[model samples]
Target: MSEKVEDRIKELEERLASTKVNKATQKSINFIKFQLARLREDLIRIASSKKGGGGGFGIKRTGDAQVAFIGFPSVGKSSLLNLLTEGNTHSKVASYDFTTVTAIPGMMNIEEAKVQLIDLPGIILGAAAGKGRGKEVLAAVRSAELVLVILCFRSDGTINLSDLKTIRMELNNAGIRLNTRVPKIVIKERTRGGIHFTYKGHQLMDADEVKSLMNDLKVRNAGVYFSEPDITPDQLIDFIFGNRIYTREFVVINKSDLMKTPISPEKITEAIGHEHWVMISAKNKENINTLRHNIFMELNLIRVFLKPPREEADMDEPIILHRGDTLEKLCRKIHKRFINDYRYSLVWGKSAKHPGQKFDNLDHIIEDGDIISIYLKR
Candidate 1:
């Protein structure tokens, strides 16, 4: 079944590539894309059902977020991990290839928050298809909140663009999408209603074509809401399948000191086509602090202080939260009991209109340096 599905997927992909994508066959193109998506989903389901062994590392998550370092062998992942952890958790570092066999877990402390960092095994050209235990490493990476793609800068001042492309392709094939926003789509099934789509901004596809494609995908009776400015067929397919992992990514160019000629940031950005990149020397600990700061900032974290009813807020020990985290999330993080016991919360920060503003909405978004006091039910 898997083989048949794979062959059909390949055929559909070829058809999509060959077919001219103009107004003459736009609907047909979208239909083909949807068919391909369904077949790929079936392939994944079949593979998961017949799995003999789960081949991935077992690293316990113990921080505000998990960040994985991925690259080819001897790309200085281990050394970077050591630097981030301040030598508290030393991964085996060597000048040779494939020194670290398994995923090594380390803890990085930023303010009062702990970030778990994983140094995964090196991947080769075909890592996504189970090469060099690439599948296992990617499986570990899929669970991370952020991925750090480490690239090597050779001594001759030449960066391997081919290696970077291979790593990106491997991650994409492993269902890990880097630095891509999730489509703001909400599809709700209905018992008795034709497909209705509501969009806030410019529509990418005609309503009739979207309905036809949805019906072809076996979504006959549903209401779809698209909140994005523009949508594409591939984005729609990804949304319906819902197996892709959308997460943040940062590129790290290691061994920058080895380069005889220093490369400008503009040249590096043009070469890599990624704005969020940093060049550093993990061995010499050059720009390690900057990397650490960038990692923390890229995580989009916010610190909220807690205040009692009559007492002052604990300004020193602030509750670490994400940028858009709400009062309900704060309650859950503080204690699971608070989830049901809390009545409302008073806010005094950028999110609130005035100091000590009473807010009953649990979904109100909290901002950085906010002071929140929760009022529980008696």
Candidate 2:
């Protein structure tokens, strides 16, 4: 199976490289890309089966959030981990390549939220193909709520584009869609009657092509809905595969202090074409505070103080939640019985219309720094 996959990959690579880019070959190109994606998916599944599901490193998730630091060898991941999580479980730091071999977990207390930080082993080229500890590293990354791509300038004072590209490719192959959202497509499987699709916005691909792809995936009876425009074949394939991960990413250009000539933020932005980035010297502890603040904001966390009955709100340690979390979800998080026993909740915060506004809707979205008191039947 591996040999067949390699042969097909080679064939597709050759065809893709030699094919002309014109309207006549657009559909053919799209189909080739889809086939390549499917083949890669097969390769990953085969590899995982061989390794067994529980072979890789596993860490019980703790804290308000989990963020992973991923980069090449000697990219200051360990240094950053130690700096961000001072006096906690410190990752080993040495002036050597691959100093860290496994995932090192640490806790960073930003404001009142305790964030779990993992320093993963460095990823090398061909990591997606099991080079270095790529499989383990990617598995760790998959479990992270956020990914911080740490990059460093080479001795020649040049940003390594090839390294960045390789890391990005490995992540892509692992089904980790960085800085991307889940496509607004819903699939409802039916018992029979074949495949049916209802598209509201403008379609990017031919309807017949979509139907053909759906049939290839063996979606014999299903209803597909596309709510957004410019949906591509790859997105459709991702939906069908159902294992793809979509998460936010923030880039960190480390070792900025070591550069002989200072590199401007504008140049870095131009090179990466990504707006969300921070420059920090983890070793020197420069801009580490700013980076912590940035991380807290990027996580989209909100603090809600729980007020019980006649007692005042516990402002010291508020319940942390993500943005857009509703009151019903909060109730479920607190306890399953709260849902049935829920009467009405009084709120005071930015989300409320006035001070101590009463709301019976469990679906009311929560806001940061909101104080709420839950009332139940006596």
| TM-score of each model, paired residue for residue | 0.84, 0.89
lDDT of 1 by residue, 1-378 (tens): 555765676688689999988977998999888887676555444433333322267567778888999999998999999999998999999989899998899999987778999998889986655568676788778778889999977767777656888898878766677889788999999996899988889988878888987887888999998888788878888888888889878999999877887678898898778789888998788998889888988999889999988899999888888998989999999998878887889999899999889877688999999999999888
CA lDDT for candidate 1? 0.83
The alpha-carbon lDDT assigned to residue 353 of candidate 2 equals 97
Error of 1 at 116 (Å): 0.6
Computed on alpha carbons, the lDDT of every model, listed in order, comes to 0.83, 0.82
Query: Lowest summed lDDT over 10 consecutive residues: which window, candidate 2?
Result: 47-56
Instruction: lDDT for model 2, please.
Output: 0.82
Candidate 1: pairs in clash: none
Residue 367 displacement (Å), model 2: 0.6
How well does candidate 1 match the true structure in TM-score terms? 0.84
Residue-level error in angstroms, candidate 1, position 94: 2.5
| lDDT tens digits, residue span 59-86, model 2 | 6678888898899999899999988998
